[model samples]
Target chain A: MTPIELRCCGQGGQGVIMTGMVVGKAAAIYEDRHATLVQSFGPEARGSTCSAQVMISDAPVPFPYVRHADILVAFSQSAYDKFVAELKPGATLIYESDLLSLDNRLPQGVVARGIGATRIATEVLGRRIVTNMVMLGFLVKQTGIVSKEAAIEALRTLVPPGTSAFNIKAFETGYQQPPE
Target chain B: MTKREAQPLRTGLHFMNGNEACAEGAIAAGCRFVAGYPITPSTEVVEHLARRFPRIGGMFIQMEDEIASSICFQGAVWAGHKAMTVTSGPGLSLMMEHIGFAAMTETPSVFINVQRAGPSTGLPTAAAQGDIMQVRWGSHGDYAIIALCPSSPQECFDLTIEAFNLAERYRCPTFLMMDETVGHMMGKVRIPDAADLTVEPRRNTTRAPGDYQPYATYDGSDVPEMTRAGDGHAIHVTGLTHNEKGYPDMSFAVHDALVRRLQRKVHTHTSELFRLEADGLDDADVVVVAFGITAGIAAYAVTQARALGRRVGLLRLITLWPFDEARIRTLTANARAVIVAEMNLGQVCLQVSRAVQGRIPVHHIGNPGGPVIEPEEILAAIEGAAT
Candidate 1:
């Protein structure tokens, strides 16, 4: 399989950072590839740009960050505007419509999808934390870099001390919810 | 009695980051104390040592800044303890004055720099080789320093321990120059039982109290035997120019003798100190020289070049400053061409070029920022040399 280079961008309180970790860990431990994760968080933990990169290669990866990415996941308008330029010619972009404006010229040779992640998390899952999981579900559906099962397993391992089932509900809400 | 056998040790495999490995390295090398500031790329080192120090009856502290961090470690070392500090580019720059202090006082210490990209805050959580020149000439005066570069996670763990041992043997502060690739990397690190490692202690000047001269050479190793601060042997410590008596005397005679002794300590002890590796040069007409993470890729390029019927070899530099001049000069002299590849905009490559002169065409692949050089590009340089 051709390796997948992914970049996740959203505000600080979102589980967008966790999305990158789940996919990166799944690619490494489950798919048996060399995986590298690099992350940067903004000044405040509440409402700031938080971004992370995950690179998976069948061979050893030399550099940690990518010049361009094969997939870019943006959960906010600031994020989409910030990193859409970093996507290469044949990249795919998934945006959260509850928070973004998408009127720019869609770059040739790339695909874009907008999903209402907040609606599914608040209405279906009855929690706000599962919103990122809703978006993550679409990512697996689109790329299959990780199975739905493996990504959930990643969440179970990565979440805080006592918050596994809430995250799993978030995942189910995301997996069942559809885009507008 | 060897210290390794003195303690029955247990070893196990664990997935760990580079920072954890460095802390473990210091502990294994008998470093009983650590003081550092909590900075990205280096915070994990402090935390691990802090956790393990209590178990082993050592000390770890999160100090105010790099200056304090540097001095605190030196203070511990002077009190007859193996001490170290971990920092990155800016922090290393801040500690340079004390680095000069360590040089002047002939204090034996170890410093690990988990380097991040920057002139000033370029990227906090990123990798960089921007500190090469700083490591060589950062201190205010003329002194020779020992630096070790490890490319893989395993080497980071091993070389860090070796760095502390070397410092203790020679009573000089050694540098473990690690960039982000190895610093944040996670891999299977097989730590051996304590019996598998050889340990060395600091040279003691207080063998007998009255005869102790802090700066006097015991084995003629250019390194003087050192007495701890409270050994009641009356050791003098200062950053200013000092004589054999360890008092600040501003005489030209004292300054010249002291500076020369510090320089000669690492410089004259060359063969035992320099660390480098040579590959495929036995039948090579061209050579590719690299250091740190770029060295691994360049080696792959050389392998492919040989398969394609070209004589290309690799000279990997694990030591910077003392420059690995002896072996590199010989390796470049035999090859018809030499190419220097690195992450910076030709910093170390310039050093390599100056060392080789015009004995061979030293082609340089310059990358100032982002994206490591591809193997094919290095192979292209090798093929370009062959033509």
Candidate 2:
């Protein structure tokens, strides 16, 4: 299979790296594909921009960093602004509707989907940190790049103990949302 | 010394970073002591060790500086424990003197340098292969050391164990030369059962106390048997040129013998020390030689070049030191040209060029610092070399 590059980004506290880890594990460990995830490392504080670039392929990923993003999951306005231009033509954009206001000009042939990830996460799960998982669930449903079972299994293994069930609930809630 | 029961291995498939995998590798290799000063791109190694070592009957100390960290683990080694220390470029700089000390004392120890770009703290969070030469000749001395470059998290796990084994086998400072990218990249690593693993037991002397000498070569073995502190052997460990008894000897003859023996112990095992992976060099016109993260990128470029009907191949260096010049010469003997790609400004490229010996045009593709070299650039070099 051709390699697919996904850029998952948000502020540091939004579980951006964890989102990438879950997706990477799902594809690499569960789905029998090779995946490499390179997270942004630096003086990234809680409210600063943080990103995880993931590449999944049938063979081992040669280039660990994302060049042209096939899918972009933006959890904050700054993240969307920072990475939107790198999306490939005819690529998919999954963004948090409550956090990002879509710009007028996007790349040609782009398909964009926005979800109120933070709102649903806070209102339904009573935890804002689960927003990234909600966004991940929407991504899995929309792209089908990884199986639902694969994503759930990956989530169980990656997230901190005692919080997997709640995160899975958030994921399911996002997965069940209408495909408008 | 009695053989201890192996630490229970975390044997299974799991997703982890290179640093985390390295820490697990150390545990699997029976490295019971670690002293480290935390630094970016390498901090995770010690952090993981700190958390895991306490539960596994191991020790992890956060030393005040890299100088202390480097030598602290050697003390543990002398105390009959397999040991390691973790650091990055700046930390490695501070530990240079101790590295030479380890070399002189013939201490079996592992030094993990998760390299970032630097003459000095150039880019703490970014990756580079800058330390390639420094690691080889960093410490002041005429000595040979073994260094391994791991391309991914899996190799990071595998090579760390190899590092310890080689350290014990040769009684020298063995290095796991990792980069920031590999250290931070998350991938799947499969750790095997402890029983299936091949750990090199410490080469401890079995002779009675008074008859044993720390630096005496017995029979055909070039490396001498070691006795730990408190083992009732009157072993004198010193940085000075020592004789068979390991005491300070000022004579040039003694120094020459000691140094040659030290170098010969590793050089004689060059066949085993050399680890390489060569792909598609059978009838290739151009071969790309790379190590660490650059090898993966070069492989991708080789694939692209092959798709374009170019005769391109890739040779990855697994063990960086004890430079396998003969193998490199033999492998690329038929190729038209060679390309050396690395993140540094032509460190390994110089070595490759020397090995090629002006037989073929050795093209170098290098980046001074962060953000790895692009595959297109490497492919371009391959195509150019082929033409």
Query: lDDT: which candidate is best?
Result: 2
| Per-residue lDDT of model 2, residues B294-314, tens digit only | 998898889889999998889
List where candidate 2 sits over 4 angstroms from the true fold. Answer: A44-46, A103-105, B1-7
User: In model 1, what are the clashing residue pairs, if there are any?
Assistant: A134-A174
Q: Top DockQ: which candidate number?
A: 2
Per-residue C-alpha lDDT of model 2 across residues A1-180, encoded as one tens digit per residue? 568999999899898888888999999989888899999888773569989999999887767878789999998999999999989998999888888888865788889988998988999879888888888899899888789999999999878899889989999988887543
Alpha-carbon DockQ of candidate 2: 0.73
lDDT, each prediction: 0.77, 0.90
Which ten contiguous residues of candidate 2 chain B have the minimum total lDDT? B1-10
Of all true interface contacts, what fraction is found in model 1?
0.05
TM-score of chain B of each: 0.94, 0.97
